[model samples]
Target chain A: MTPNTTTADPLRKAASGIAGLDEITFGGLPAGRPTLIAGAAGCGKTLFALTFLVKGATAYDEPGVFMSFEERADDLIDNVSSLGYDLPGLIADKKLVIDYVRVERSEIEQSGEYDLEGLFVRLGHAIDKIGAKRVVLDTLEALFSGLGDGPVLRSELRRLFQWLKDRGVTAVITAERGPEGQLTRHGLEEYVSDCVIALDNRVDEQITTRRLRVMKYRGSAHGTNEYPFLIDKGGISVLPVTSAGLSHSISDEVVSSGVAGIDAMLGVGGFYRGSSVLLSGPSGTGKTTFGSHFVNAACLAGNRAIYFSFEESPEQIVRNMRSVGLNLDSHVTAGLLRFESSRPSLFGLEMHLVLMIRQIDQFDPAVVVIDPISAFRGSESEIHATLLRLVDYLKVKGITVVFNNLVNGDQDDRNEQSLSSLMDVWVGLHDLEANGERNRGLFVLKARGMSHSNQIREYRLGSDGVTLIEPYIGPHGVLTGSARIVQEAQEEAATLERRDEVNRRKREFTEKKSAAERQIAETREALQREEAELLALETVDERKEQILTASRSAAATRRGATA
Target chain B: MTSPTTPDPMGEDGAEISDDGIFHFRLYVAGQTPKSLAAIRNLTLLCDAHLPGRHKIEVLDLAENPELAAQDQIIAIPTLVRSLPPPLKRMIGTLSDPDKFLIGLDYSRPTS
Candidate 1:
């Protein structure tokens, strides 16, 4: 093979720490191919690339080399250490090489020909020394500014990419997000690389959001949607929106929600074990009350329970439930119940799922309660798919999860219905206003395997906790919720009772007539038996008289008569 | 005819090449009775070696993966598919002619 004419040998690929990401990019980064990750500052460009390298070394056992042009190695390590990534440890183990190449353009001897040969040498040495299969040149924007003119820098960059590719090491070259309509400072890196990923951070309606897009991946299909990510304690976790295959094993054991009537209405007296139950209602409709009851039941059954509160803090929840008569503090202290309280805005919805799954793994709870799933509605609709995955993850762990949804107004929340299909049971709490007061009504909207009473039960939140009353049923229908409905039902029931009393009197009259008929039949049988006895006695008398007459006619006949 | 144990010729493409450099390939075939597996392997080997490196030889034994025989496309073992390098090509059974394989890969037929 002639020099510079060697056949294009296949490049070694880099592995994405993300599961679906690797699958999308066949066999990882086109081994030694220069992939561009361009995004604005604070747009997670550095985080994404670092996670890629860190996950490669830690998770995939592929050593990596990180050549940072912007931040110092210590700062990078400190920033990411909270995300459960031990960057310092990886460096200590010599599995990762972090090279901070600070370029001072002012101090450079610009008079001489500028070449990246030194950088190439250093990068090569680091990669070869560490046996690295992956390389990340973070914030290549610094290089553009460091090298005065664009022409030399562009050519050098081109050569660098080629050099990396020829060596067959996967490389991630990050560039800063530029002005509108431009990807980076030079805008040429996007065209040079075989794969391009664009990250973005924006505040929509005062809500901060982060999203990532695989702008291009040559020869491979990638998820094209704007995947929302979170800068959380675990670095960055992409929500692989796609389902993990539709083979969720169904369960036959119906699990109870601890409410007898609710379980009864659910058809099988409970939901299927490991199934999800959605408690949907408007504010103050007792979503928490129902969820708390369930958690209490799970804990009482010797199962650990985890309550994720998005609205109320753990302390506030504990205090508030005191009026409902639930002592969550004891459970928490005992470690049977874990209260994970965070604002809905604490992290992206996927992060919520990840963190919840993490907490679940840590606590290994048998029951998980989300006080109100609606708290997550602030996230993009794309999160719905991720939420489904989270639900499945919980179910697969045999954890009975309860999502308390606050159904706003009378919009006939579709979220409840959509989630109900995945859930084993759904309880709807309605707040009805009647008789100058608001009363809560609890109804089992749907329960898959259990037989639950269809009647809406009236309930009240009081010092002792929630009181569920079997509402009166009358001629009109079964009453639920407020006192007025109950009173009207009671009045109708009174009318029905009056009507039943009259009917019962009429039945008694007919029964008396039947008794009199039976007495007459007995008297007739007595008369017949007396008549037969009298006939027999008269026949005997006739025989005796004949014998007496015979005796008088003939004394000797008496002996004959006796004989 | 060469002995059945003879190794397939390797082409010059750094891949094992055969007599036909155009269809440079090698298929290590052990036995006969082309089932589905045989058909796929044969076709792939043919394509990897013969069709612009598109034709590759794939050998399949009838004893393993027994269900391969049911396919209508493949009637025998060791099928080959020469997909690339233009005029796509295919061959069945133990591919016999190196000249034919090269021709399939768009190589000029060697004057014998």
Candidate 2:
């Protein structure tokens, strides 16, 4: 529901090659409208305008004209040569044309009704000569100084803008920051077409930082904050915090956190390949050790990894991790791991982000680890926002990130909670005391779209890198260190004693049964002997009676025989 | 509307009905804008008072004859060009001031 006049017509746009600028402006500046870029000297006003023209000529195949009122064409070429833009090549290829508009107020005479017809004619001729779709009037204020102040100046300025618009050429007009609510000293702010972009280069505490703000953009919705920008060998790049919406494709591919035990704690044996992981712990809780494990694992998998250590230098990190048995030098030599270590305060927070992103893009790392993001001494909210942006960027590119942060208290780092909320896996590491022993414990607080263990494992750090071990859960509570070892030993001793007691009782019962069997056999032999003696006595008495009966044998012989 | 046959209001000062030296006047205008109308009226009055019937005033509507403006190098509208004279003189803007108009048209003074 837009009621704008140009809204009815399709808004033509020119793509500016500066990083994050097009995203903020919703696809670059409005086409055919004069965008006034105002800022102080050395704020990259000229660079911004020149980069726009050069990028247009080289990338879009759109020829452009650069009408400079300040620098000569040779100086302009030399100034931008360091950025690797081939100004002469573009000119030779008929993609770019530069014109030096020399103006001197002393030589100009305002007699009779005189229009700025000469300028219009020259500009029109230049635009037509190259079929330019883009034009840059760098430092339009210089022309104002050359031509002394008058009503004609303002009207002429308006006419020039109108002429550029009618010619349908996208124009970038630069001006110096005027004092007290003015866009330029000449007060030709009203003459600028639909957009006004302001550049800021400021130094705080001996640290220089550049910022870009889109003051106004008609017919488009643009990011309104002062995004910190960097002007290095790559030219101007603005780090926009959250312009990247949640449109990145979801990946189910699991990647190890480099620690097998830590992977076991995750739902899918590892984290999603294109997810963010937060390893927050108090100081000396093996945060970097965990990060190193991830980096090492990534290298082992033949995937690239970049470790940004704000607390330690590259050599120091390599040496320290080597002491823990994590040989990062091999990975570095193999070009699989890049250790980018610098002091957190070496530059502003935004500069660090730019450098980090540039490195990531160059290295094309699959995993990025920022060991202890809390080392940045910005405000709490600022740090949180920065972390969110970093995590968001890596995730969008499907680059897994393991951010190690140190928690100060018994809980998760308060400042990192907001960022932690967006993390796919939040593994909080903290030093705990149990059974008169202190040790580090790691637990997965949350793992979206997967099942993760809720148990906290003792995080053991040694020269061979980090390992997780089960803690003692006994009547005295979860125990660790020598106390846990002692308790486990005691339990083992009791189990052995139970086995020994059962074996000894069985042996005693077997020996008693054998003794009882011998005694019963002796009793049976004695009873059999008594019975034999009684039977012999009875036979002897019967024999004597038979002898007496033999006297009367004749008659009893038959009976005896019968008997 | 006043016809050429009608006597001029400022006849007592200088007004005659002779065509010996006919002065020609051409006023360029896009349309009947107030400024263009003013320039026409002012130029006509000056011509009538100074040269009376000896001058012929012609008005060119540039809206109808848009291509004619380029010939006299007319950047501003309501420009007056003295084409009949050997050496052409030009004036821009509404010719409200008669003295300036006379000076622009190379008219020395009216000989009453």
Candidate 3:
């Protein structure tokens, strides 16, 4: 008996057409089958269903039937108009149908053995009228509450699901999130469907983020993590960051760090074209300045760049950077550089990531700068997770990313340390003080695969941009700021004092030599004069000795006395 | 009120099974599944015991005519619709339990 292998499961998929959603699901919802999208209030359950139907009818050329159990047709259309979906027009053109089924438990009477044949007849007729391939039973559980709980209702729902499947129509049935781990308010809905997508709106630190997770997909593989989704003017956009693995291509070409000295510090005269750089520093350590330089350098090279500022507004960034000679206005005018500055508290980290990723893709920047990644105030693990995803995504795309992180104390900042390895080059900028003045010190913490310089350059944030001072060193450590000037002056003065002392000692020795020469000449003259007088006395003594010629013995005695 | 009505009295074999003197039972099914065949067989046996050729059993397959499912207000498969009775009674499911079935149609069996 050969086991049947002809598509035994026969899995088919339908693209939901929601951005990043299909990628996470590996495809869309199961085709020609019912998929349950469950969530709590205001979690975009209704909008998601509407978007699916609208996108289906518009993009896939497959007409759809929207059987709403909660909202009226007009309200649905009006509420979804902001997303630019023309439901009424689609309905008029026979591309879509909207049927609002309102059930009142108080006004209805259920005789014995009565099933929901009316709903089936209506749904069936609607499906047949348009030959629809897509169907949405929004808030399908509303009927359960209206009809009361019974086996008849449950069995009828099962029949309805099977009937839809048998008719070969892919359907989306939405329900309220049930208690605990239930996918739907009524547990039976998920069992009858082929796929179940759960939406959750979580608020932490007063910032809310909508996340989507595929609880179960019967046939196909899917992302298990709860991917964060955004509901803006356009609609829901899921950020499948982690699902998009690190399979993106790499680049070995070198690019400048915008500052020449900093580029010199890194190997290859700059950073790799797509490598990630972390410019970490304390507050006001010119992290933003370095970011501006990168943007400027990228734009000057005729490549696009996007700067996400979590601490300042766009105008404020432009205005602040103007003082540093980084004229970003022209780049903004030329559309080569984009500045997206938003307060970190405005949204959750994931939403910011969605916005950033969306902007990055739309702009297709060659370089991306996120100033102060420290703005995320989630749990340590959460921040790490976000940054990890951000780095991984940018790296895979071969888009160079520079994240400016601020570290407070000398202690190892876990947040910065956690993301250090993902960085291809980590440049730590510091606020160093030695002699009553603050200075900026920069060092390459690590540069992967590059023979980067190990010297710490004292950088200057001047009116014309970042410049690295010479590696001036002294006994007081690396000299910088006023300390450098003061030490140089002190050294110069000490050298001059040493020269003056040597010159004074030479002058005193010359004066003493002339006086000693004068003294020796005087003594020689005096000795000569005395020896002449003694010669005269010796002559007189010779005359006296001649007078006493007879006295030879006396001369000998005189000689002996002289001796 | 005791006499059953004879409306479109057609049986599975194109013979008139009811002529106002017979109880009419329309057993709706979705083709030849085991459950549908079992329902037809059980209904025929019950009718043979109770009415002794005084009842007409008409079997309708929804698979052949899905549109007819709407006409008979049929939702669940393998239903028994007693159309001829003054007060129309509909019993859904495979009718595996004869006691539940008889009681569902407002009938009492002779002492259990």
Candidate 4:
């Protein structure tokens, strides 16, 4: 009995080699123990098991044997070839062996007493043939349908698991999910108690998403959340929400917002490197424009950028950006920018995330932009979770990301409030309507660890790109659009009129002073003339008196001498 | 038993004499276990009473040739595969019940 043992030594794990799976499992599946992969039909259980085997053979150098009870060996080889697994090559190299176990119930009759020693011998023989350290029994539950006696099959299955454990080979057993919450149809989960992983293919809102969750891991701590997984040509990749802790290293370096005005508003010159920035607003608020500006700026600076366009195709985005004088096609040609466009309803939110992450990993971009992330068709929580993981992943990689969100008029505040906490900078865009015109206004709502402008700056989209206009603060209120323009015009006219009035009053005062000075000059000239005339009269009288005195002076001179 | 059925034309080596009216049985077993021994004894007794000289039994031990387990698609230890009755049939067990064993082999009991 392999009870949950807490020993000083940790449980050793064999790396599954699937992307993001090891990180979530804290390493990988338990080594030398059977792990039950229970899922409904077509949930990729077989693919998951085969990937484990193939990756073990090629990557980890551990040989594996696949004992299939459902699919034939050739068919399995053909099916996984699309995923680029060279099963035949692996077999030729003696690194892998495939045994297809065909059980026909109609052809076999149970007589009295029998055991599955034949199965054990076949499995053991296959294991020894390649000296395998890993084994995959894909859909082992087919034996239950092939064999009639349930009690005997059950006991044999129990023993088979024990035998596999004694062989010390890491085994993965795929089982069909049972009805009504049972983990497996044949209760195979009971036998493989070391690890149990459940895969789910759920259709939400007409979109299918595949998710994986580790139900139980004995003596190991693993991520319990259902991580979305993608099965493409490259094989299965689980998108684990790696936000186990907020431990990603931050950068003090800043990245440009592409638009100079927007950068100025952020006050830090741009967004912090590796920080998430949210561009949220109502429709037609230039959210995508802002995101494109950032992408264009990043590409211009020789940093690779990925623009995830959910609503528009790459051609459409390029064409639309052309109207704003942003030539993104050149960047695409230079391979400095990549545009990944998909309909939001193409798959679930998690699928979008997985695809985006896959592209990001391939491109190894320095910046990422999700244009209109609100275009994704999913529940709020699912979108939130996807964004959370995406943000965490980008931050961990030091990739600056910009998320464009389109909020409806009424739900603007609520939407911002919901996603605001996850962003390092929140730039809110809105349509300001006044004076019978709608103008785009942009404001930095919150910028963590930096000072940002709270004032809304009116911006215009033109052939030269986004142009920010200084807000017009009037007596009534802060005005924007044509209202602000009209207010500015009125203020200019008023200033002109006041200057004219002052000029007119100064001219009147100068004229009054000049007129008074002329009057004083005239009066002073008249007084001087009167004094000269009086002097003339006095001189004439003195002349007459002198004549009289001259005549009397002769006589008075002698008397005067005596006086 | 039905007058010894043509006086036992075949040799003691149990070689295939002809394809017509021949019941060639191949019993696959791991080793000389009790179940394998029981199945061999029960099959011999049933064949002698029912099929008489028309039956041939071949025992293949998987312990000696383990590769045959996968080749013959064997899962149970004491498995009897009837190859020459036209349509091949497989029965797994010790064959402890005679009536059920005969029915599984599609053989009718001789009415005396």
lDDT of each residue in A1-563, candidate 1, tens digit only: 12332225443356787644565555565555778888877888888888888888988887999988888889999988888889889988878988887655532322212345446656766787779988998876677676564676777777777787677667788988778888887785644558888888867545667777888876556677776666776567655444545566767765667665566566666677788888888987778877887887778787899999999888988888888888888888888999999888766566677677768888999888997788884533545676677777876777888998888857887665567666767778887665577777888777765566778777777776777776776454555555546677777899999999999998998899899999999999999999999999999999999999887879876667887
Q: How many times do residue backbones clash in model 4?
A: 0
Local distance difference test values of all predictions, in order: 0.68, 0.78, 0.81, 0.87
Clashes of each: 58, 3, 0, 0
Error of 2 at A476 (Å): 2.6
* lDDT (Cα) of model 2: 0.78
Model 4 Cα lDDT, one tens digit per residue, B1-112: 2332323322233333344777899999988888899999988987987877878999999988999999999988899998876567789999887666666665533333
Q: State the TM-score of the second chain for every model.
A: 0.36, 0.74, 0.73, 0.78
Place model 3 in a CAPRI quality band.
incorrect
lDDT of 2 by residue, A1-563 (tens): 22233324446688987888998898898887789998988899889999999889988877898988788889999999999988999899888888776554433322233344445555666677789999999877876676566676678788788878777788999989988777776765688848999898877656677889999898788999998888889887887766366778899899998888888888799999889888887788888888888989999999999999998888988888998898999999999999898888778877898889889988999999997787777767767677777777887899999888776756545677677676888988877776566887788989988998887788688877887887567685666777778889999999999999999998998898888998899999889998999999999999999987876777777677876
Number of the predicted model whose lDDT against the real structure is largest: 4
The 10 consecutive residues of candidate 2 chain A with the worst lDDT sum are: A106-115
Chain B alone, candidate 3, TM-score of 0.73
| Recovered fraction of real interface contacts per model | 0.00, 0.01, 0.06, 0.84
Ranking by TM-score: 4, 3, 2, 1
Candidate 4, residue A436: how far the Cα is off, in Å? 3.7
Error (Å) of candidate 1 at residue A306 is 2.9
Q: Which structure is stronger by lDDT: 3 or 4?
A: 4
DockQ versus reference, model 2: 0.03
Candidates 1 and 2, the one with greater lDDT: 2
**Which of candidates 1 and 3 reaches a greater DockQ?**
3
- On TM-score, the leading prediction is 4
Per-model i-RMS: 28.0, 8.3, 6.5, 0.8
Scored on chain A only, each candidate's TM-score is 0.77, 0.83, 0.85, 0.88
